[model samples]
Target: MTDDAPNSSTPPGLLPAGLMDLLPPEAEREAVLVETLMAAFAGHGYERVKPPLLEFEDSLLAGSGAAVAEQTFRLMDPVSQRMMGLRADTTPQVARIAATRLGLQPRPLRLCYAGQVLRVRGTQLAPERQLPQTGIELIGSDAPAADAEVALVAAAALAAAGVPSVSLDITLPTMAPALLEAAEVPPALRQRLARALDRKDAASVAALSGEAGPLAAALPVLLAAAGPADGALAALAGVELPPAARAIADNAAAVIAAIRARAPGLRITLDPVEFRGFRYHVGVAFTLYGPGTTGELARGGRYMSLNEEPATGMSLYPDAVLRAAPAPAPRPRVFVPAGTPEAALQALRAQGFATVAALSAADSPKGLRCSHRLVDGRAVPISKEG
Candidate 1:
């Protein structure tokens, strides 16, 4: 066969990379998951907000937007004759809403959002360039309680979505950067240290920062202490850090303590030097993972909204959340034969059955996967053999 010839099993209408069409009940499951999460957020007083898919490039790329600018897809707006962008992340849009539209609202605005985001590229772990994210943004508060509250609320939402035995990993992305700055490390060495931390390599961190004096001595300890939360916090407490860096560590400890108080059963871990996906987070950040899952199920942390107001929140990946949830109970489907009384069909629907009306004489209810069929003025279950 020629190189371009399609294989026998390869069907037509192939989708582009990082995109897939959801068919059947899977699509319905996703919608239900989103609604369940939104309801959980609402229970915690986070009002729902929807931002448009496209916005002027300048507004969309401002502040935290700069961190995700590369992933955003840009287009030209015909009316304004200006560049526009399809948002790669909804957090930035929510931040914009807080800063501009909801400017006059009370302090500590609690806002939640659910929407699809389009990215230009995808990572190995998450290949879908199109993603559905549902999250909350707690703006204008930097207290440790705010941090802890968001974490627990996220966990609560996951539980509501039926994700079991969830574990949370909290990371301090700002810790290493602050220590490097305090040590007066140059730009080149700082980049090297960051790369080492990404690999969880303590030896490289020590070697790179060895000449920076006291800060160099503590780098190895910090990297080594990244595991269980209690032990990691104990190790961190002994390290003599600069005043500013120490405060950040203290905030993280407080948040962890608060979470423990609220959810003693929840598993928690700490990583002081993790800096992979949190480019804009300024304080305690977290990622949620579950057993049998390939990548992080959700991620959130403290960051400046609009690069001005302090904000803390988390976003759950709908696809991951659905994967982690128990499979939904099968839907109740019934088939109404042609010439069946309209009242009968209405009664079936009222009785919690999903009715499928017969369009032709040859259409069998069994062929449609219907669990029951209306026959002779009565609804009866379909038999397996017959």
Candidate 2:
């Protein structure tokens, strides 16, 4: 081999940044993982639904979906000439489906979906603009038990995907906003408190809420209470919350109780101050993380469906789920020699071996990287002597 470096010119057809093509086994494994999650959701009574990748911009970005408006990719439809948007999230599309085609269906509709979504941007934690997501929506119920059901189903799906060491972080997106409203915190100070809480900065929270009264004073205390479920609940109990905020706390407690009943062994944490990544979540929300995974494995929360019915659901990122899954064993590949009879090769394949037939008469079963070779009328192991 020459010591000179190879040509480094840009290829004629390279993909855009933050987009990539999945190759071979990795792509196959991701497909398997998505199916596993869908099966898990189906087991919990969630029916699968498919929505088009693009839709009218107005409806797609309406209601709670407005939160993701900036992330949507917009275009002019060739037929309608109306502005259309490539979905950045599928939950809204599912909601639209529920409101229209499935509107006549009975209450408590359990729907699940698996598809690819395109976003205009990507965060540092998840650098891929295009992603595969699988999720379930529990629509038409506002009960706290609905929240717990969604959470439990999400955990079960992750477990089915071979990611068992997951930690679920539960939060109330409305907690800080409710507290600020209850405490009559001025608009300026509320913004400061929001920023500080988003960063989990206790000192700044305290500094901003110094003279805002006892309810406001609880801001720092709540910030400190972001940890294990038991401790966080105990800490929350001591904080004097206004009636609206107190109601939220009660709903969370109920959701926790229901989750404990369903999945007692799951690791759960509470972060009442975590307000990020839950733009449209109106109630209790959660994010799942594998033991050593950098970003969240999945996220879900309570929201309204079609701006009419109460709904709760969760969405899981296949890329992260696959990253956290156990490595799959290689498939058994059997290589057939060039002169091997077609009947013998068929026999090998019928026995569940992945047979690779030689293309030319000079081709032998050597160095093909297959696990076994067709010898005589049987697939036999390739010995060192061969």
Candidate 3:
């Protein structure tokens, strides 16, 4: 901040750093979505995994191929400058928990996490540094069936969250990476080209590739290769893709078929642009976008599903999701007194009430500010203006 800017000490009704103040209704809405999601996760026998928010850089990194390495926040440890970091993503930590920490526990470890991840994605993602991500990671299995199951689970989770008309835009990085390699592009130029391809701007892609000879030969086929599940698969029909590409395609097709079998009428698209980014995702990745928003509302894939280093998993920006979910009933909040006993509280919870037990107006106003959630009757819960 500039010296001309207001001093940090001059604050009430001010926020610090990247933290945000969510009102009761907003908080309650999130809780409702989470409730549905946790039930979905549990109904299918996926065990819950809660990793710590902080970890040593080694553990979170675990020698992986993620953009998280740069985004991780560093800190000096009181004992040693071992360089701790607030985790940028939880998959690597969950992978570690699966592979070594809980290896003896089970096969095909099904795990889900709901927590806030800190990162530095560019402004296109709104530069909102701290985001809440709730997702699943299935380890110890790379079955095509596993891939299908996860896609289904992802779709189901979005459905449970009250997100409708969800679209699964799928892709395989293997083929595009191979095709670019066959064209003998440089790393820097290839990055620029991939970006253009992501934007679906063939003119820019051709310019970046610098030779129409390759791009002209490649771009049309790539650009034309977009549509519904079966039709898009036809684009790749009988073409001999590289081995990695072929495997990726077959697996992706299986996933699409699985989704179709389970949930008909759900739209599925095949586009290489869907792979997310060059540095982050891998084979069989997808983002679930739909009617409410221009950008992706939810995304996940079978990234680092293997024993590879630098694990990959999906993350949902909760605020982004809140923006994407259709408007809900404005906050439903009630007040509860400070000294409510546990037994009474459980009874209220059994009826789907969220109890806010703070005493004073300052301490308890938050209870009433939330929608569809209530304060435990002790505190005066309504807005003063109301």
What's the lDDT for candidate 2? 0.87
Score each candidate by Cα lDDT.
0.88, 0.87, 0.66
Residues 68-112, model 3: lDDT tens digits: 788888787788768788887766677878777786865677888
Q: Which parts of model 3 have CA positions greater than 4 angstroms off?
A: 1-12, 16-18, 121-125, 186-192, 204-216, 238-240, 278-280, 309-313, 326-386
Query: How far out, in Å, is residue 286 in model 3?
Result: 1.0
Report the error of model 3 at residue 153, Å: 1.0
lDDT of 2 by residue, 225-322 (tens): 99999888888888899888888888888899999998898889998878877488889998988878446889989987785789999999999888
Listed in order, each prediction's TM-score against the native is: 0.94, 0.92, 0.78
For each of the candidates, give the backbone clash count.
0, 0, 16
Clashing pairs in 1: none
- lDDT (Cα, tens digit) per residue for candidate 1, span 1-386: 89998767646778779999988899999999999999999999999999999999999988888899999999989898999999999999999999999998998999999999999999887789999999998999988889898888888998898976789999998888888888888888778878887887777878877866677567889899989999889878999899878998899899998899899999999988777675889898899997775367789999998848999989889998887789888777888867777788888888878888889988887788898877775668888875
Report lDDT (Cα) of residue 200, candidate 3. 80
**Which residue segments of model 1 deviate by more than 4 Å?**
1-12, 376-378
Q: Which candidate is the best by TM-score?
A: 1
